[model samples]
Target: MFKYAWICKNPDLKGMARRAILQAMDTKPYSTWLEIDLGAIKNNIKQLKAMTGTRLMAVIKANAYGHGVLTVAKAAEQAGASWLGVARMEEALNLRAAGIKSEVMVLGYTSPVM
Candidate 1:
């Protein structure tokens, strides 16, 4: 299981650390980092688009299969994905909270109340 030492609720603070000893200008500054090749994603999308006339829907579930949800979703958008798909409301919420304007649909069962 994964555990985090801190979490911030204030959206105004981009890089705020809720309980870290030092504050930074980027959120998750001290968190584990991964490199996602958005260009590669864009290229893949272009290839897929070439083969299919059907509208493209980017499944961004499970953090884009560990490719990072926000980054992949943004790249997919730039690559002409017609819609973004998430497996849960939290995933959709995260995308929206990050300012993603793509059409998003939750693919999994969800509770009615927030």
Candidate 2:
């Protein structure tokens, strides 16, 4: 996997990039908002459990990789997720903002300046 270590080192830049990407898109801001289907995520987790019968963790970094982190984290929890992983503090904060009560692990480091 191509790790975004550079992004990890600079959160302000990451935020700017996110805003820029959103602004650059030739679509309405409302259209950029994504509605994640928690039920679908739960169903998929159930299916995976039935097939594998192993522990499952939800990777919810990068706004759930653009699927909305908190939404997906909630679904993953409802579907019996044993762990939740994120790539940055902001992503974890997003989950927290959504009132998701789950163990969120930040996969990378955050400078003290953060």
Candidate 3:
């Protein structure tokens, strides 16, 4: 199995590259994946609101714990999450790209020197 790691000229190709990598990985002895249910997330958020009676904030850091950050954030927003938490600026940027208007907080460390 070949581990392909390369930067593409077109940024949008990254997802395609990821798929190719996964397909290549299928030949490996071990692999992993996570299945996320947006319906479940919405239901859970509703339950939290009912129990706490307070606005809920969702932490989607670490690529939403490997559950696709954009999908989770959108569901969370629709489910009444006032804010989304991310550990990297890239994650926040991705949320913005997805047209998410909810506030996104970056919990990762930043350098002032830049």
Candidate 4:
């Protein structure tokens, strides 16, 4: 069995209601998993672009920190990121294969043998 709990010092009623609904939903038991809000990523990217007033790069290295590189990269690009940064040539190649058109920078060294 899985237990879900939300503890907050100042709880908003609406937020509590939402949390209750989420807890009621069926989910498989897993030792670990990730729940990513892609909309939040996009919104944050937009906010950063607005604040910086300069081109921004969305680093999707390490599979976007395990949040799915392709999805995160697309959201970041759509939200006005001028470039995507990856840690390796393979990661950049994967993005290109996925039809990601944004400019990509591999911040790590690539082996000549590859």
**Candidate 4 residues 1-114, lDDT tens each?**
555566666669658866777777758687986789989999999999899899999998999988899989999989989999999999999999999999999999988897
lDDT of 3 by residue, 39-87 (tens): 9999999899889999789999997887888888989999999899999
Residue-wise lDDT of candidate 1 within 1-112, one digit each (tens)? 2344545566546244433335332356456777877898899888898898777889989999988788899899999998899999999999999999889999999998
User: Global CA lDDT of candidate 2, please?
Assistant: 0.78
Task: Please state every model's RMSD to the true fold in angstroms.
Answer: 10.9, 10.4, 10.1, 12.8
TM-scores for the candidates: 0.64, 0.58, 0.69, 0.70
Error of 1 at 91 (Å): 0.8
lDDT of each: 0.83, 0.78, 0.87, 0.90
Note the residue pairs that clash in candidate 1: 15-26, 15-27
TM-score-better candidate, 1 vs 3: 3
Weakest ten-residue segment in model 3 by summed lDDT: 26-35
> Tens digits of per-residue lDDT for model 2 on 27-90?
6556355566788889998898889999877887877787766667878999998778998888
Sort order, TM-score high to low? 4, 3, 1, 2
**Reference-based TM-score, model 1:** 0.64
lDDT of model 3, residue 83: 90
Cα error of candidate 2 at position 94, Å: 3.6
